[model samples]
Target: MPVSKPLRKALQHTADECIDCGKCMTYCRFLAESGSPLSIALTALSADENVDALSHRTYDCSACGLCSAVCPVNAEPDNIFTELRYHAQANGIFKLDQYAPLLNYERLGQRFPFKGESLPEGCTTVFFPGCTLPAMFPDATRIAFKILKRNNPKTGLVLNCCSKPSKMLGLKSKYEESLSALVHTLERKGIKKILTACPNCHVTFKQFNTRLEIVSIYEELKKSSFLPVTPSVKEVTVHDPCVTRSEDSIHKAVRELLKAMGVRVLEMKHNKSNTLCCGEGGGTNMHNNAYARNWSRKRINEAQRTGVPMATYCAGCVNFLGSDYPTAHILDLLLVKRKSIPKPVAFPFNYLNRLIFRFTAL
Candidate 1:
């Protein structure tokens, strides 16, 4: 697990680019409270001093990309932190045991991928509902696929993990190999377009496999005539997942979907570009549950301050944030007809949903 020369150089370059203006620190909750801003940590890395301190700071980062988003010089501290994780791993400073559960989850996904057989002959577009959605909301997953097929008869369904867990965990080589293989498989099957349900999957596909067209299902739904059997809820605070902070189009589509369902969308204190992580980004929650939960609680508290329930498009977000406050997936608000607010999918059931989707939907 030697760190690549290019990555080392890139880390050094990122460190060199830091001007110590403290903009990233001003925005990053982890850094602001911890007193070890990325700029300071990167400087220490370049100086080859306080290596242990640097490793701790890097591991503690949520990798939400907010630091990078606010960096005036585009220093990309978030990317730097990822590279630092790899660096620590190569140096035997970071252990894998803490992340065993997440790694095992990813291993299962890679081993038991669910490539559905519901596509028409010569279909070039596949609806990829990523692992979380199919695992948490199988019915919504099915409905989304049917809507896609209705809009275009050639639309198909492909259920699989996007290997984002590996990527976020700094298993760079493994992630690249698996993702590339998946992309090649889809290309061989003439999958020119991928309709993604998970924001992480959407970002991962667009980042790793640029050869194919990657579009969010939310965006696709906007172009279709499908309307949700609106729920009884009137207003909700939309928690835009951190992965799609830069994806204005996806954000717009999610809000529009809510408006179409006659629900008034309330903005969180941090929404859109400034949205906080749901504690799952960069696989931080796998290693640091308390830290992750604190972030989720902060978000839930903010939503509660608005006197409305929390709503998010990401199934992962709903699962994590729902524990702290009343949270529902936008699909639940749009699609489910429950007389009461929908509950988040619990653990064993979520895992069961993944298995059921593979056997039944495929």
Candidate 2:
């Protein structure tokens, strides 16, 4: 692929900034002897040098930002990958398949139940349930909605995709178009505050310059006292998504939420600020499934070491570990024994309305 002058300059800039301090190796499992040279070469190469090879390694990146954190010089390997993904897609070095689940965002505006329906006039906060939350894990989705309705019935929700997957997949044009639609939808509905459940979506939409206040649904639960205590004893390990824990407070919030639910929170040694990538975030799941599965398996094994089920805030993390661990969303844990267990979809276990009372009341 022929790289333009501007792209070449950017790649050179990335290579020049890297200090080769080996800090990135700690976060990458694939940074062994043979791959070391490839990493170095990719770092050193101009944007035009071996576009396929660059894009191949780029797709391998989960874009977790761990490398940036560990770097003594503060060099950002993930941002370099992001820049490359943009340049590569624009220059024809990358292409995403049509049916890839990430592309579902483009179809969301038309399919959402709230499309033509009007939200209540007086509602100030609207829950924007991202697509994966509802489709992949229906039971958890119901619990999230149930929690909001039980405490704050006035809260309306705009159900649809956030188009982050599309952006990660290098479909920049499509991502922007979908985002514009979503923005208009919120504007038309008079939604001023958005409560997002999906970590990826929450972070993605937060990047846009908009007036609507975006807050995590978990944050709202923490403040509104909307979450109910359930009697359930389960040792749970949480897999923090790279996108969600940028500031590390989300990790603490998740732990607090779990502890409040009577679930013993077990830490993965590499958790909190140092959590491993979920392998789905930065286009890896779409471009390379086997790699994503391998990473997910590694995480599942770590969770299994604790001898308990796992919980995560991100739907992608749960979907990534489907059927591998006795995993459920944090909302699912909260819903246990309160409402009837929602029918198990092809996703995480609901386990709601089945709370083990022995574990209740702190």
Best by TM-score: 1
List model 2 lDDT by residue over 37-138, tens digit each.
Answer: 225445447345665557546766677777666666645556656666766677776666643655644464336332323256687777776666655555
lDDT of 1 at 10: 59
Model 1 CA lDDT for position 278? 87
Q: How many backbone clashes does candidate 1 have?
A: 0
- What overall lDDT goes with each candidate model? 0.78, 0.64
TM-score of each: 0.92, 0.82
Model 2 misplacement above 4 A: 1-13, 30-47, 51-53, 105-118, 149-153, 227-231, 338-344, 347-362
Root-mean-square deviation of Cα positions for candidate 2 versus the true structure, in angstroms: 6.1
Model 1, range 1-362, lDDT digits (tens) per residue?
34456555656666677687877676566677665344554554555545545655566678888777777887766765777666666566777788888778777776755444456798999998877887778888877777888888888877667888878766778888889988898888888999988998999998884699999988888888987885768898899999888999999999999999888988988899888888877677767677677677778778888999888889988877777788878776677677766677888898888888888766
